[model samples]
Target: MYSVVVEANVQYEKESFTIVGLPVVPIKKSKECILSYQHTLGIDITMKKITIHLSPADASPPSQPN
Candidate 1:
């Protein structure tokens, strides 16, 4: 297991993050993808502040954006 924090997208808002309890490069990339979309497709937001956690075979952390 591992813990990795990364900024991600929200409900058409700025970016949050996903705390990876068992993260890797791909996991971090995934979070980045969400952040990008949020900055592009989602609403107008730019808050690189969030946390992500990864478990057995997935990442789970706090709720949506802050």
Candidate 2:
């Protein structure tokens, strides 16, 4: 299992989400992963514009909030 650094995105006017910074597959999965964590764990995580760079950049990308 690889840990991919994921950044979140919320579509305007709609509650839909998008995950950026990971491989397309994992990033897609992150949508559910993050939503579950926030919903069940009660972490009101929201998304805004960001810039990411993960260590070993290829492994996982990190993001900086703007």
Question: Which stretches of candidate 2 lie above 4 Å from their native place?
Answer: 6-16, 45-66
lDDT per residue (tens digit) for residues 1-66 in model 2: 654443433433533344444467755565666567778987653443323322223553336799
Q: Please report the candidate that would top lDDT against the real structure.
A: 1
TM-score of each: 0.35, 0.43
Query: Model 1: per-residue lDDT, tens digit, 1-66?
Result: 445454433443356556454438777776676567768876544555455443443445548886
Model 1 alpha-carbon miss at residue 19, Å: 3.7
Deviation of model 1 at 60, angstroms: 11
- Candidate 2, number of clashes: 7
